[model samples]
Structures are given as C-alpha cells and as structure tokens.
Target: MGRSDVRPSRSSPLAWGVLGLWLLVVVLALPLAGQLGESTEDEGVDYLPASAESTEVARLTELLPGGDTTDLLLVAQRPGGLTAEDRALVERRLERIDALFDVAAGDPAAAGVVSGDGGTALHPFSLGELGEEEQGQAVGEIRELIADPPQGLTLALGGPGALGVDAEAVFESIDVTLMLATAGIVAVLLVLTYRSPLLWLLPLFAVGVAAVAAMALVNGLVSWFDLTVTTMSSSIMTVLIFGAGTDYALLLVARYREELRRLPGAGEAMAAALRGCGPALLASSGTVSLGLLCLTFADLNSSSGLGPVGAVGVLCALAVMVTLLPALLVLLGRRVFWPLVPRHGESRATGRDTFFARLGSSISRRPVTVLVGGTLLLGALALGTFRLPGPLAEQDNFTETPASVRAMELVADAFPERSGQPIAVLADADHAQEVREAALATDGVAEAEAGREGGGWREIQVFATDPPESEGEQATVDALRERLAELPEAKALVGGPTAQTMDLADTASHDQRLVIPLVLTVVLLVLAVLLRALVAPLLLLAAVVASWGAAMGLGGLVFGPVLGFEGLDAQVPLLSFVFCVALGVDYGIFLMHRMREEALNGADTRTAALDALRTTGGVIASAGVVLAATFCVLAGMPMVVMAEMGFVVAVGVLLDTFLVRTYLVTSASWLLGRRVWWPGPLGRRPAAPGQRAAVDAVPAGAGPRGDAG
Candidate 1:
C-alpha cells in the first residue's frame, strides 16, 4: 500500500483538469486575439501626448463637420520631367481616385497641392468621416490604382492615410513572425538545456497556455477598464509571456530534477521544488509587473497602455508556470528526464560538473580582482553612450525603404525649397484670413493658404522652406506655434507629420525623466522585501543599473557606426532601461535567494556564495539564452527603433546572466561574506569554518526546500 514509483495515483485527474482548463482558455482567447488588431490606433492623433496642444487640435478637428481628417499624398515623378502624356495620366488618375470614394467630397480643386518642379509633384487629397479600417482600405486601393502608371512616371503614396496602412502592415507581420520565432527559440533552447525530448515539451505547452491566458486577460482588461491596447503592446506582451514563462519553468523543473535524486514519489519531489523556488519566482514577477505599471505615469497613451498589458502578461506566466507546469511534470514522473534520470538514493552528479564550480573557485581566490575588472569593463562599455545619435527620423523607421519613404525622399530631391509634409493650423474661422497671412509671414514659411471652415474652425495649410523633419522645418514649425499662440481669439493649434514626431520625441524625454526614477524605486522596494535586507538590495540595484548603462553604451556603438544607423528612437533608452533592470534582476534573485538559504542553514560566507553559484549557474545561463533570443526577434522587424530596443535588451540580459550575476555579484558576495545579509539574523552569525558546513546544510531526511533552486 506504499506509493508506487510509477503510480497512476491522483495525478491523472489533476493533469487532465489542468490541461482542460488551459485548452478552454485558449479557445476563449482565439476570438479575442482576432479582435485585438481592431484595438490598435496608429493615426497621427493616437501618438500625441494627451496634454499637448496638438491633441486638443486633433480632438476639435474630429468634432468638426467632418468626423476626422485623413490626408493622402499622390506623387508622380519622372526623372527628367513630366511630359504631356504623364501630366494627362496624373490628372485622369487624380480624378479617378476622387470619384472612387466620397472621401474627397468631389473637390478636385482641393487636390492640386503640388511641387513647383514639373519632375515631381504631390497632391493633397483629404478625406473625412471614415473608420480606421475604411481609411486603410482606401489607401490600399489608391495605391493599387496608382500603379501601372505612364512608363516613365514613378508613383508613390505618403501622408496620414498611407503611413497608417504601412504601419499596420508592419505590425501585422511582426505579431505572427515574432510569436513563431520566439516559440522556436524556446523549444530549441529547452531541448538543449534538458537533453530530454519529453521534458522540453511540457514547459513549451505550459508557456503556450500562459500566452493564451495573457491575451484573453489583456483583452478583458481593455474591454472592462477601457484601457488602451495598441498593436505594439499586444506583440510585445506575447514575447514577454513566452520568455518569462519559460524562465519560471526552467527554475522549477531544474529544482524538481535535483529533488528526484532523493525523493521516491514524483508528487513529493515536485511539491518540494515549488516550495523552494516559489517565493523567489513570485517576487521576481512582482518586480517586473509593478515596474511595468509604473509606466502608467507616462503621458503618451501607447506607452501607458503597455503598462497594464505587459503586467498582465507576466502575471499570467507566473500562474501557468506555477500550476500547470508542475502538474504535467508530476504526471509524467521521473522518466521526464529520460536516460539522464535521477533516482532515489543515488550518488549526486559531482563526477564531472565543474564548469560553474571552477568559475566560483576562481572568483573566490581573487574576489577583489574579478569585481574590479568587471566594473571597469562595464564602465568602458558604458562610455559608448556619448556616441549615440539623436531622435530617429520617420524616413529611417522602415528597414527596407517603403514606397511612402521613397516618395518623401523623391519629393525632397526635386523640390529643394518645399516640405514634403506641411503643418496644419486649426484656427477660428473669424480670422481665417489673418491666420493665413500670419502663417505666410512666419520666418521659415515657404507658402501658406487657407483651406476649409467648419464648426467655427478653419484649416490653414503652411509649408516649410526645408524638407520635413529637417532642422529648418522644425524651426519653422516652432515659429508658427509661437506666432499662432499670440492669437488667443483665433485659438490656433498646429499639427502634422513633423509635429507628431517632435511631440513624440518630447514625450519620450519627459517619460524617461519621470518613469526611470519611479521604476527604480518600485524595483528597489521589491528587492528589499524579497531579499529582506537593506544593503543587499542597494547593491543589487546598483549592479543592474550599471549593466543597463553598459548595454546602452554598447548599443550606441553598434547603432551608429557599426550597424550604420543614423539615430536611436527617442523611446529606446527608456524602454531598454526598464526591461534590462526588471528582467535581468530575475537571474540575480535566483542566485542570491539560493545564497540566502545556504547562509540561513549556516554555511560560512565563502562556502555559501560558491555553493549558490555552483548549484544555480546552469539554470540561470539557460534562462538568459531563452530571454535574449526572444527579445532579439524584434531585431528582424522592419522598424529601426524596435531593432535597437531588441539589441540593447538582449545584450543587457547576457551581461546580467554571465558577467554581472556570474562574476561580479558572486565576487562581491564572496568578499562581503556574511555581511552581505546585513541586519539579517544570518548576517550576525559567525561561520563554522569552510567546506564541511556546505555539505551539512540539509541533513538526513529534511525536505528538498532546504537547498535547491
């Protein structure tokens, strides 16, 4: 009546129930995932900071006689000059487009905003009162019809409508590609780490459950709370769930394998493993989720929305990994490890496992040297920060030049004095003429003209003397804003493609100043409570921050000269910093938590630090590889900003896993000894000499929670 080693037991019911629940979650999420794309807003107004003047203008314009304005540019270029045939083709096509949709409202005269040069000309075709899906489709159809132009003419589309379609297309591909790449990376890494085909499948399935649950929960949050959910947030959340969920699984499964060496029953072994690592996993997830929530303070809707969505992902990963993963592993029993199986009462595997042990011993011999050397190296890498470029231009956004960017470039080349994108001034209709004159007189104004009047507001189109997003145009936009601000009676506000970019840059700078300190404080508090020590938390925070700076500095070097990038995205530093610290600290927690257990069990400082490294290093390395690979998937994306963010985060994680946690933190702890646990009872105790005490931390029949994971 003793428990059988291969017993069917109660695990059958638990396994089936867990699997069924997860399957149900996936089924529920499928429809929600399909609807998630609808939640994304990529319009120029969508990115504006709520308090920005442009946002007010956008809102007022939305409520005008037209619901919202969508601008599309139709450009036709001939290398030499447009012939009579090309001009005829252009006129016919422009009319055809206006006729295709009531969008332009039968206003052919309004569609004649063109470059002075006969070789390149772009018309301003405006539409209003359309849904986003409708707007994108309209752009797609225009692009299709504009093709097969006169043989010598080059046609391309840009402006609000075309840009939205291009952005949406990029994000659509990002979602499917990132998920498949992440899943493949995890599956391969898990197989390599476990060396057991069956063992890798359980965690993969468990993480899949976590991803589906996260999507469903996030959709629910968006629906119930009216929180914003962008296409960007949804895709990023998927990577987080897969990467973080697999990390939790690795920690739990590794501990379970170690426990199986002494415990006869799979249930007992798994339970013991969870008890050992559960608190650390919970606390680490807390740090990430709460740190993400700190982003709610951001003024930009897209950045703030990522806060709740990302937090939901990490929490869902924790739930599935802790519950479903353990159940499946127990159901599969010790055979999960296959030919490399651990058996009860067998000799432990010290026969050839000396990689991390040797590393620890080497550091133990010269702790000061390793600590000093690591700091200097990271500091040198940090120097690359000075090399980083400024705010990335919209033309540089795409990996391969899209037709939209190409059109903008061609317009720039052919029309040296005219801007490809114009500033749209919304002013009171009473002084619409005065506003047009004021815009025309502005210092950098190339030309200005009054357009439409509705809902007490009129549109004044102003062109800059320089190309869009160039310094001269930025000056002109500023002049327009300042001059327009003087007309209180007019209630003027300026916005357009260039203004949106400027506002995004300003908002990013503002959010970084606000969110960085808040995230640091939040993470520090979590570390303090989890580690239950003052000094250690401070030390850990310092190390993670150092790691992030080094990562960024390295990014600067590669991003500019090495990778041939012109500039970093305005949001790259803020986004990279948050992820590096929040996620990188997981490895630190794994290492230090194990060290804490050893110290609590009375191993001397040196022995405990070395023992912790020896036991936990492999799992930490594996987790780092999986996380790094997942983030690097963003590099393959068409957007340069995403590529930079991914590269920075991936590098930072590797630094955290191998250099900082493995060498620097380990060495620091070795030097600090029991003092590393300052104010803790363990910190006050004297050591009972060296190597022998490590062997006796958990004696005879004590539970596996005493030492593993």
Candidate 2:
C-alpha cells in the first residue's frame, strides 16, 4: 500500500475550477475594501490634566455643575511671548477644531478654550463619547490645521484623540512589519531548503493565494459581526498562512523526492507523495488550527478576534498545500531538483550532517547527563521570571515617534494629576442622587464629577491621587464600590483607567488558573491520540512546560534587571504559554513521527533515534530558525510590550527546537523503544508480508535517482 506504483484518482480540472472560482470571488470582493476603509468613532473619553494649579479649583466649578469630564487637551505654544495677534489666531483655530466634533450639551463651558503658562494655550475639546475612528480623524484634522503653522507659534494636539491617532499608526506599522518579516523569513527558508529557485517559489505562490483569500474573508467577518478586527490581524494571518503553507510544502516535496526515485514517471511520483503524506499533513494542520481556535475563550476582544481568523488562514493554507502544491510539483517534475540531482550509483548519504542529530546521539548515549544539565540550565533561566516588570508606561502602547514621546512627556509634566489614575463610577439611573451622595462620602476620592442626568441613570468621574494599577488605586475602587452598594438607589459599576487595570489583573488571574489547565489537558489528550502512548505525551508535555517556564524566567530577568522594570506584563504569561505550547508540539510531532517510521522499518531503538534525528533535524531546525527570526522582528517595534513578546517567543522557539525537541524527546524515545506505543495495536510485531514488501520497496537510505551509477 505504501509503494510508489499506486496512483490516486486525479481531479485536475475540478481543482483548477475551484481555484478559478476562488479568484472570481476575490475579484468581486475588491470593491468592498473601499467601503471598509472608513474609520470608526471613539466611544469613550479620556481626560488629561491642566497645567495651572488654579485649574483644579476651576475644575471644581465644572464638577459641581454636573457635566461630562473634559476628554481633549489642545496645547498651543509660541516663542518669546503671545502677541495679541497670536492669541487671536490661536483662539480662532481652537474654536474651529472644537466645532469639528460634537460636544456634550449639558455644560457649554466644557467646550471652551483656555491658555496655559507663558505664551502656551490649552483648549479642551468635548468628544461626547465618539468612536475611535472619529477621535482619530479629529486629531488628524487638528494636526493638519497646525501643519504649516504661523510665525513664532507651534501647535501640539494632546488628549485621547492624539493618543488614538498615535496608537493607530503604531499598530499599522506592526502589521506591515510582521507581514514583511514573515515573507522574508519564508523566502530565505525556502531558498535554503530546496536550493532551487523554482522549488522555492512554489510555496510562496501557494501562500500568496491563501493569504489574499484569508484577508478578504476575515474583513468580511469583522464587518458581519461588528467586531473590531485587531491591529494584529495581519501578523496573525502572516504567521498562519506562511508557516502552515511552507510546512506542507516541505512534507510534500520531501516525500515527492523519495517517490520519484522509485516511481516510473512524474505523475506517479506526485500521486505516491500525496497518498503517503497527505493524511499526515491534514492531521497536523487540523491540530494547529484547532489549537489557535482555542484562543476564542480569551476574555480580551483582540485575542478572541484572532482565533477564528487565524484558524481560517491555517485551514486555507493547508488546502492550498495539499492541492495547489502537488499540482505545481507535478508540473515541474525532475527540474525542481535540477543542477544537482543525486548520482544514481552513489551512496545516498549527503556530507551535510546536522548539529541536532549529533546532539541527539550524544543525549541518547547519556540521557541522565543530558537531562540533568538541561534541567539546571532551564532552572537558572527560570529564575529571571521573579524579576520581570510591569508595563514601562501607559504611552508604551504608542509608537516612539518624536511627536508621541513629546506628547507623553508634556502630558506627564503639565498634568501630574492626569498622568495615570482616572476612574468612572456608574450607578442605576433611578438612584443617581443616592449614588452621587454615596460616592462623595467615599474616602480616598480626591474629587467626583457627575455625568449627564439622563433617564435617572448616573455616571461620575472619580479622580484619585493614587497611580493606576497600584494598591492604592485598587483600594479606592474597592471603597467606592462598597459605598455605592450600601445605597438603595444605586448598583455601582466602576470602570476606567484604574478600574480597567484591576479588571485586567483579575481576568488574567482567573484565566491563568482556569484556562491553562484546560488547554494543557486538551493538548495532552491530543498528543496521546497522535502518539498512541500515554507516557510519551505526559513526558513531552512536561518538557514543553519546563521550557516555557525557563523562557518566561529569562524574559523576566532581562526585562527587570537590564531594563529596570517592575514585573512582567500581566498578559505575557498567557500569551507565552499558548505560543510556546502550540509551536513546541510541532517539533515533538516531527521528531516522533520520524522515529515511529524508523522503528516500523526495523531499526533498533537507539539506531532509530539517531536515524530519526538525522533525517528530521534539518527540517526542524530550518522551521525553528524561520519562526524565531520572524518573532524576533517584533523586538524592533517601538513598544516595550512587543519587544518583550518578540524576545520571549524567539527564545522559546530556540529552546524547544534545540534543547527539548532534539535532546529530551529523542532521548526519551530511545529509552522507550517499542514501548513508546505500548498498549496500542501498533506496538505488536511487524507482519511478515509487510516486512517483505517494505524491504523490497526501498532501503532505509535511498537516493533520489534509481541506481547508484
């Protein structure tokens, strides 16, 4: 059944028809891109501090009046002094900007302009709870208005609007960078793997088609659900499409080379390769796609959005790899491996031995030495986790452009009160008065401003002296919630910068406690089914977990001591865990699959381990190198969070491929021998006829050419 003579039914015309239909659909969807280009509106307001000490006193008047909090701060500065003409020009420009967006009607004073110390001026624009896109546009227009500027005077837009604009730009760069990096890595890997330009181009073409389709589909889905397609969608798509598509191509081509050596013609070789490897490719892709789909359980909207879209890309890539790749390979034939076809009579052994195979052999010879040494190294690295720090700053989310950094520094300097801590407390509409009274009575609340009086529901702005995410901030939130609960008329909903920090912490804690175990359990079960051995899965999972802990610990150490941060970002653990586990499994799968094949073909346990590593190590190393390089590019991003993520993933990939997958997994397989698949029917001795057929088909080491000429 595994012979290269048998051919599966060919559906070339049907395959081409489907490809044509997919292209037609994409061509039709191109028009929708224009409609989707429109920006969204900001739905909330973010308040910044005023430079004047007396502004706080003035703020009290607005608070007493019961109006929405100021969400925009416009800063106008002029050298030397503000002349009468400069003041007039600044005021007129500020008024025009303020009029561009709708402001709350309750307090008209909230929409006015004010001047700062020296020749600088400030204007507070009322966002009236606009969406993100509107806020961005408003900021863009403000920027455009001040682009040329008048003599001696410069304008700087500060507030949530500016922040939104900065964030959007940063995210856009991240998307573009990730895509380009993934493409570059794939191109390099393909060139290295095939050493043939034509073969290298095949995977790229297949992935391109999958990528275009995946993007169009993802955008359509985002529109259908009114979901915010995360700024990371492109990164997610790049990883899925390129990684999975290239992986499939590698498997197909590797098998195709072997089959062509035995089969009479190119068509027979293609059929044989597809029949032998197609099912395995499908299974591997299915596992990965499902793993990514598990992210839908993430509480964060951004992560959840990635789940389905990433899954779609992976599935599409798999389809293209199986169908399109094979079609292309059949068309190219022996020319795909031209310029260096193996001499028919020569030994199949290539002089290029891999480092991983040598390392695996050394480990098999001394598992205890390898295991202990590896564990200690990992343990030392894991110590770094204790020193990891929290986010560097709130502005760390934005790009490190001069404007953004200057805006951040200016905001911090001019408005210490608005630097971090801000909260919004809401209560039942019917109990607005009672809730306001309760809130006013709460301790640690520096000031409270009531929101618009509408339908008996009330929202209040609470400014506290404590920094956001600090113990004091949580205390203020707790005290306010407790006070509001005692009021008969109000059920308090506390949410804002400080509240969001607390909520994120709480959500992360809950997810870590619940989601990790659930995901691990699922992964272990899947591994068990694939390996047909409970022991192997357990041990493999243990190795992966250790590697993950070590990676995090190392990240924490670098970020804390070298970078001088407090602790790791709250979300880092979850993100790292998911990425490490899923990608780590790919290495384990490759190694174990090769080992199983070797054992079934009559190699001894030790020999099989060596043979498996020798055959599969190059592929695994190439894949790991590409993945690590792609992830490492994230460090180039301006945001510290992205940099940390990039470093962590890069390290994890290296550790999994080099240390754990090459040494630990191979050593364990060698030790287990035939027992690796114990209790399964596969564990039994090979059938005589099967052994005879396998021996007749080909030797363990065969060249791509028929005879050793």
Candidate 3:
C-alpha cells in the first residue's frame, strides 16, 4: 500500500479560499482585545447573585452620595511593634495616598485616614462615579505611594479596592502568560504524540485562530448583551477553546489519517474523514455546550455567565477544527503526518492491540472484580472529603501571599483581637441616628461612626471585635442585620467585605445544590439521546460522577496539606463538577459512540468494546493529555481558586481517560454485554455482514492508546 494506492489530491482551490477568509476575519477582530481588557470586570457586584442581599446592598450603596466607595486599608508595621515614628510615617503616606486619590477621583478628602492601635492605619477611600479606567489608575497610584514607606515601617494596601485591582492585574496577565503556557504544553504533547516538528503547528495554529475568534465574539456579546466577562469566566473560556479544540482536532486528524490509508486522494480522504468522525466531534462539543448552558439557571451570576462564554468557546473551536483544520490538512496533503506519513493501504499503524487492548482483555477475564475494585477505590478516596479545607477567606485567595494579605496579617497582630476588618451598615437617613446607636450598643461593636449620607440613605461604619469573614464576625453581622430588621423604617442593609464573602459562600453552596443535579441531568439526557440506550447513558454518567468525587477527594487531601491552601474555594466543587461531568462524558461518548457504531455494523458486544478501545485508545489518550495539561497549566497561576480548579479537573480528566473510560466502562460494557445497550436495536440485533470477531486474544493493558502520555 504505497504510492500505487495513493492518488493525487484534486486541485481544489476552495480550501485556500476558506483559509484566506478566516485570516481576514481574525485580522479585523484582533484589535477588540484591548477594549476587552478594559472591560474585564472583577468587581464585587460582578460575582454576586443578581438578587442576593449583598447585591442589593452593593447597588443601594452606589445610589448613595458619590457612586461607590473605594475602601482601602493602609498598613504600617514594625517587627517589635509600632513606634511613634511608625505612626507618623503611616500618617504621611496616608496623606499622600489621599491626595493622589482625590486628584484621580475629582473629590476632596471625605473619610479621614486614621491608624488603628498606632501600628497600622485604615484609609478607607470612598469615591463616587469614576470610570473603570480612572478607578484602576487611582488604585494603581495608591499602590505606588505605599510601594515604599519610611525606614522600618512597611506599608501595604488592602480592602475591596486592592483586591479588585490585584484581580484585574492577574486577568491582564492571561493574554501573555496563560496563553503561552497553554501553547507550550500543547506543543510538547503534540510533538510527543505526532513526533513531527511541522505537524504539531497546524492544530496549534487552528487553536490560536479559534481563540481570537471566540474572544472577539465574547467581547461583542459583553459589549452589547447581558453576557458578563469576568476574570474567571474569560480564563475558563480560553482554556476551553485550546483544550477542547485540540481534542476535536485530535479526533479529526486521527480519522483523517485512517482515511488516508484507504482513500486515494488527500481531498477525498478528508471528506471521508469528516464524514466518519464529524458527527461524534460535533456531538461531543454539543454535549459540553448544553451542559454548560444549563448553568444559566444558576442563581450565581458569575457562574451562570460562564455557561454561555464556555459554550461559545466550544462552538467556535468546533467550527474551526471541523472547517479550518480539515481544509489545512487537505491543503497540506500527506505531509501533515510527516516522517510517519501514511501510505495507501498500510492501515496507518493502527496502534491497536496495544496496552489498552490488554486492559480490555483483562477486564473481559474478570469483569466483576475490576468493576467492584474500581468502585471501592473511588469510594475510599471520597473519604478524603472529610479532611477538605474550610471556607476560603479573602486573605487566603492568592497562591503567593500578596502585600494586602500581609498587611491584613500585620493588622491582626498589632490590633490583635479587634474585628480585623470593618462591617458596613446601610440604613435610611431618617433612622440613621437610631441605627448608629444600635450598632454602637451591639456586644461585638468595638466602635461605630457615621459615614456619608445621601440619596435618602446613610452608612454607618461598625468595627466589630472579630476578624474579617471569621465565624465570630458572621455572628455579629447576623445580629446587626436582625436588629436593623426590627427598625423597618431604617431599611438597613448589612454589606461590605464580610457580608459579600458570606453571600458568595452561601451562593456557592446553593449553586452546588441546584446546579449539580441539573448538570448531571443535562449530560445524562444528551448521552441517552445520542446513544439511544438508557442503561449505557446511566453507566457513562455514573463513571463521570465517580470520577468527579474521586478528583475532589484527592483535592481535599492535596489542597490543604500539599498545595498549602487553607480551604477549598467555595466555587471549586461546583466548577470542578461542571467540568469533570461535562468533559468526562466526552470520553464515554468517544468510546460508546464507536462501540455502538461497531455494534450497529453487526459486531458482537464484546468484540465491539475491544475494537472500540483498540481503535480509539491513542486519540482518546492524546485528547485526555491535551485537555488535562491545558487545565494543569492553571495550577501555576497565583490565585488559589484557579489552581484548585485546575488540579481537580486535571486529575478528573486523567482518571476518566485512563481508568474509567479504559477500564471501568469497558468492563461494564463487557459484563452487561448486550444489556449495556439495553432498549437499543443494537443490543438485540446480531452482527452485520462484514463485522469480524474480537482481535486475536491480545494480552491485557496492550491497547495502542495505552501510552499513558
């Protein structure tokens, strides 16, 4: 099967035309990224549930006096404790920060900057009605002023202002750092898988095109619609485009390579390749997209926004991989396969009867043992959830300790036992005096002061005896809210850092309860419809859910003890579940779709499972590695939440790839035999005319896709 069987590709200039048009589109849309950067929202309101109490408080506060208040903490500390000189240094820096901020915000000093216990200072800068850029510049200037303090006195910024600014800085870095990291990873994996220098670049180039297109599309949506773009969602979208796009590319390229062996011409081979695998790729992408869109019902706006953004990424990646990628391969002809290029009728290395072949045979030998053992292992790992970290605090958000976190630490030490942070209370101006008195009289209140009053509302700053986001402080807030509720005329709202954190944490919990079941239901329904077998879909979802639980259990053991996380980010479990289940179902589809194809073509159930594993082992494993590595790239990020999410997804993908898809699902398919495909005609029908028996008794764990790369 050499050149004798290889026919020349047709002179189809249309492929080149497609490439040219997409390139032109990319050129026109690339400039929108700059505008998108300015639009990357990381504000408190951006993350909260639309109708949550905290969201209302944030809104009401904006309506008061100047649009919004920029709370900033100026920390000054000395190792031995604060000295007179330290206090004076803090005062001077606060004055400088205030002046710079006032200039940027076009407002005079309103809330005075005062030191706490003479060790550090609280310079809560409340500004109104500034553009996002102006606010960023003001925060930047403030950060710079505190950049270097007087000798022996260290100054660091904290509060909502500092957190928002820092978050935006990380998001801005994604353009360069996260993208480069993802590309580097994909390149290495592709090189190892394809073993060709030039071959790897084609799929990578397609991913880049998809990424740009998706970003521009997202920017347009954000610019014109309710689609919100935050640092978290934007990052997740980038990962989806590269990771999932590459997954689709792997499947298409694998099929195209197979077609190249049998078909005469490259153009004809690509057409056949798309004909064979196009539905599976589109189905997988659709499954992921639908699962993500189900998040729209989520009460958490930030999480819900990711639904559409992620769906956009998958759809865009699908468009490029299916169209642009196939066009490129057709244009390049056999050269895309490089040194290992497939000649006609050579069967393209087949890579069957490898480690996975052996694994499938092993499962066939003792199906029940493998199934029970795998389930027990996963269940045991689930026990680690007992050791999982507690609720994440703002100070613990960073992978590396930032100055703000350090500043909070200093305040905690110097003002030991004082409400490490302030509690903000908003009440009607008519009942303002009463609210202030009530707050001061509260048992946890260390001090209370009246804040800016406007728009028929007044704010009161209540410094509690407990630290920020701590349970004790939570109790104080609850009490304050309850007391305020008694005065209906006050229309008091409890907000600020602590309140926002409480709301976010509670929302995450609620979203978990609501979104998880919906996500599972969505994925399962898609699988059932696609496979036409209720039992098979249930098995696939069960494996995915098990994988998620195992991944999180592993995360519980690793995050706090190994990664040094104090607690799992409230959002990690939900995000991880969404990713693991949605994408995990992908592997199941890859296997079952092929098995069903084989079964429908008249192969027996056992032969079909082995053949599916035999043929798909390489592509599935390669796809898994690409997706896992792309996610693992997030582990290097400075944010603890992103790191945890990355770890869990990486672990889950690998587990689903090597263990569940390869072993558990395959064994289940064999044990259930025809019953695995229950209610489907494929389950009841006999072999088709050309279908053959299982490949000659391959040893266990020897499928071609078993490289574990």
Over 4 Å off, model 3: 1-8, 67-69, 79-81, 87-152, 348-353, 441-443, 686-709
The most accurate candidate by lDDT is 1
Summing lDDT over every window of 10 consecutive residues in candidate 3, give the lowest-scoring window. 700-709
Q: What is candidate 2's local distance difference test score?
A: 0.63
Instruction: Tell me which of candidates 1 and 2 scores higher on TM-score.
Output: 1
RMSD of each: 4.8, 7.9, 4.2
Backbone clash total for model 3 is 17
Candidates in order, TM-scores: namely 0.92, 0.81, 0.92
Ranking by TM-score: 1, 3, 2
Better of 2 and 3 by lDDT: 3
> Where is model 1 poorest over a 10-residue stretch in terms of lDDT?
700-709
Encode model 1's per-residue lDDT on 1-709: one tens digit a residue.
2334444335667767886787777898878866766666665566567777767777776676644667677777887777878778778887788777766443532435455656776676677667767977888888888888867789888766677677777877887888899899899999999998688998898888888777777877878898887766787798899889999999999898888777877888888998899989998899899988988999887788889999999999999998888888877787677757777766665532479987876776566789999999999999999999877787787777777777777778878878866687899999888888889888999888776678889988789989888888888889999998888888888987677678888898899999999999998888888787866777788898999999999988888787777778877888788899999988998998998887776677667788889899999999999999999987767888779988999999999999999999988876676678777766666655433343323223322211221
Per-model lDDT: 0.80, 0.63, 0.80
For candidate 2, lDDT tens digit of each residue in 128-221?
6555556667667767876777877766766654665676667656766777877887898789888886778888888877777677666777
Residue range 197-225, candidate 3, lDDT tens digits: 78899999999999888888888889889
